[model samples]
Target: MCQRGIKVTHVSKGSSSTKIQRFIPLANGLTDNMKSFAVFLLVLRYLSVSHGCTCMEGPQQFPAVQIDAGQGNVVMTDGNNYAYFLLGSQWYKMGSLNLKHVSVGPAGIWGVDLNNRVYKYVAGSFVFANGESLQQVDAGGDGQVVGVTDTSTIHCLKSTIASDYRKQSTLSWTTITGGLMYFSCSSKYGCWGVNSLQNIYFTRVTPSTCGISGWIQVDGLAVMVEIGTDGSVFVVTRGGEVFQRQGIDSSTPQGTSWTKIPMPSRISHVSYDRGNLWVVTDYGTILKCLY
Candidate 1:
C-alpha cells in the first residue's frame, strides 16, 4: 500500500515566538557569527518542511494497522490485532478479543476479528453480534452499521438494532446490493465505497431500514475511501496519494474534483474526524494531522 526511500520529517505546530526561542540555547560552543548562521539554517529547514498541514506523532504509534475515529472517540488495532481505545490522552486496551478491523460511530464501536466474526463494544467488553461474518465493518452510518464480507457482499445492520450499548440486544444485518472491497458511511450524505476494480461509487442509504439507492459511479480510481462525519470525503489511491473531495455539500454530494492533501510519507490507512486526520504510514508511523 506504500513505497519506501522517503525519510519521514515530523512537523509540528508551535507559536512563532516559541520557535525562535527554541534555537536560543543551541548557540553554545560556537562563534557569534557561526551561531547566527546555524540558527538561520535550522529555521529555514523547519519552514521548508512545515507546509499544508501540521502533523505530530500520535500518542501510541505502535505500528497501527487500522484506525477509526468518530464522535470524539478513537479506536485502533496494533500489528498484533490487539484493540485499543483512546481515552483523554491515554490509550486503554479494550477487551481480550483480537480484532483485525475496528470502527466507531453513532451506532457503536464494532469490529471484525481475524475469523470474520462480528463483535460490538458493550459496557467494557466486546460482545458477539449475532452470527454475522464480515471482513470489515463500519459503524459510522446514521442509526445503523454496514459491512462487507470476504466475498465483497455488502450488509447493513437492521434498523431494529439499538445503538445504546446498555441494551445488549441481538443485532442482525440485511444484505445490500452491490459488491465493495472497501466502504465507509456518513450520517449526512449516506455512504461511499470502492470496488475491487478501483472504481469509486456513492449511494444514499436509509438509516431506518438499511435501504440503499442505486450506485452512482464517480470519476476516479481509489484503493480505499473514508467519509467524515461532517459529510467530507477522503480517498487514498493505489499509488498512496491522498485527496479530499472538493465543493461537497448538501447539493453536490459527489463533489466537483479532488484536492490533494500533502503527506510527509506514504500512507496506507487514513481516518478523519473533527479537524484531525489520522494516518498510518508505510513504515508503521501514526500521525495525527491538523489542517
Candidate 2:
C-alpha cells in the first residue's frame, strides 16, 4: 500500500500555458515540481511519491494498486513515456508489475467511468496494433511484454499499464504530451490528427515539392484543439493562427499545422507513438499515419 494522510483536502489546479509554473497541492503539503511528480509537455502528470524520473534506471516498479480492466478495447504508446492515474486523495505504489494500458505507451491514455469516475492511461494496455513489442524483444530476456489492439477504451486498466513507459521513453522525444494530434520538427513531420469529430490524418512539410502538400485533412473526431509551431498550421477558424507551446516541446518536435483529419472509425480515438501516429475508427478499424 502507499502513504495516505488522513483528512487531506484542497487539490490545487491551474493552466500552465498562460501563468507562472506552479506545483499541484498534495493531500498533505505543497507538491514540488521535479520533486514528487514528472511533468511532460506540461499537459498532465501522474501522482507519485518521488519527483524527477531516473533516466539511467528509468521508471520504477510499484507495490501493486487497484486497476480493474474490462472488456475489449485497445491501448498504445508513442513508443515512449505515459502516465496512468491522476493520483489524488492518496498516492500508492504497486509491486514491480505495471498495469500498463497496452504493453507500452506514448500512444495516449484512456479512462473507464462506470460510476462516472474519469481517469487516464494509454491505448495499448488493453490492446495493441498487432505488432510485437520492439522494446521487449530488444531487451533480450528482461521479460518485457507488449501488444496491439483496437482503440475503443473498453476498460479502465489500459492507462495504468502504459504509465511505466516514461522510464524508457527518456532518450527520445524531447517531451511527451497527451494529445489527439501531434507533429514534429526534429523528424521533419508536419502533423498527426483527426477531425473535430475524431477523423484521422497525417501531413508534413512539402518544401518546394516533397510530394505531400498542404496539411492533409484525413477524416476523424476527438481532434478537440491544437496549436502549431513556427512554419506550422493555425488553430482558430482556419485563418492566421499557429499551434505553439513554450517551455514544452519548445524545440518544436510537434505539429505546427492544425487541420482535422478524417477518422474511418466514427467512434475511434487518437494516440501518438514516437511521431508514428495511430488511431482506431468506429468500425473497430485501426489506422496509422505514414510519413
Candidate 3:
C-alpha cells in the first residue's frame, strides 16, 4: 500500500519554509532497513533543491581521513593510511598499500603515501610513480595534475607524462609559483588552492600544456578545496564548515560568492563530482551527499 500526502518541512538559516510532499510506499514484508532507505532517498531529493544543500546520513559508515569521487567511483584513505574503494554500497580494501591521500579523474587514480611518495593504480595494485615527493595530489583535471610538496612547493605534472604516465619512462613535474597546503583543479575552470595561512587562491591553468599563470587571491579562508567535473567549487573550513561556489560559468570562473551547506557534523574534507558530494567528518565518518 502507498501512503499519500506525507509532509516534511524545510527549515534552515536564510531559507523560507517549504513543504515536501511525497508518496511513501509501504507494503508487506518491507524490512525496517528498506523502509529507512526509502525515507533517506526522499529527504535527499528534497534537500537537493532547498536552500544551499543538506547532506543526509549515507549507507557508508567507514571512517575516512580523506575522500574523492569521480564519475561514479569513490575512493578514500583511513586514519591508518590504508586505501579503500567503493563499489555500489560496499567498500573494498585496495591491496595493502598505505596512502594518506588519493584522487581519481581522467588521468587515472593517483595517491601519495605518508612519506609523500607518489603511486599510480595499475594491475589492481598501486605502483610507484617516478615523480618527486608530494604530500597531496589531485588528478581531477582533463589531463592536468597538480600536487603540493612537504615544503608547500606546488608542482604540476607535465602534459606529456600525464597523457601516458603508465608507459612513460620517467614522470616530470613543473614547479608552479607560490606555495599551497591544499590544491584542486577542474577541467572547466582551471585550479584553486589554499596556502598555509588558509588563504584561498585561484589561477587559470593551461591543462593542455600543464602551465599556470600568476595566482589570484580569492576572498575567504579554507583548509581544503575540491572541484567538480562541471566546474563547481567546494571548500571546507578549519571549523569543519562547508561552502559551495555559486554562479560559476565561462564568464565567472571564480564564481560570485559562497553558499553554506548544512551538515550533520563537522567535516574535514569534501569532494564533488558528477552529482554526488562525498564528505569526510572530523571523526573520520564518511557521507555521500547528492547535490
> How many clashes (backbone N, Cα, C below 3 Å) per candidate?
0, 80, 0
How many angstroms is residue 93 displaced in model 2 relative to the true structure, after the best TM-score fit?
A: 22
Per-residue error at 231 for model 1, in Å? 0.8
Where is model 2 more than 4 Å wrong at Cα?
Answer: 1-111, 117-256, 260-267
Measured against the true structure, the TM-scores of the candidates, in listed sequence, are 0.81, 0.23, 0.81
Query: Residues 1-291, candidate 2, lDDT per residue (tens digit)?
Result: 112211212245644433324433322353443332232212222212122211011122121111111111123222122223313322222122233322222223332222222222333332222212211100000111111112311111122333444332311111112222222221223434333344444443232222233344442233322212222221222321212222223354333333333222232233332322333332222333322
Q: Mind giving the per-residue lDDT tens digits that candidate 3 earns over 104-198?
A: 88777889998999988876888888768999999888777889998999988865577576642557788888999999987788789999999
Q: Is candidate 1 or candidate 2 better by TM-score?
A: 1
What are the lDDT scores of the predictions, listed in order? 0.80, 0.26, 0.77
Better of 1 and 2 by lDDT: 1
- Higher lDDT: candidate 1 or 3? 1
Q: Could you list the CA RMSD of all candidates, in the order they appear? A: 8.3, 19.6, 8.2
Clashing pairs in 1: none
The regions of model 3 sitting more than 4 angstroms off are: 1-54, 59-61, 167-169
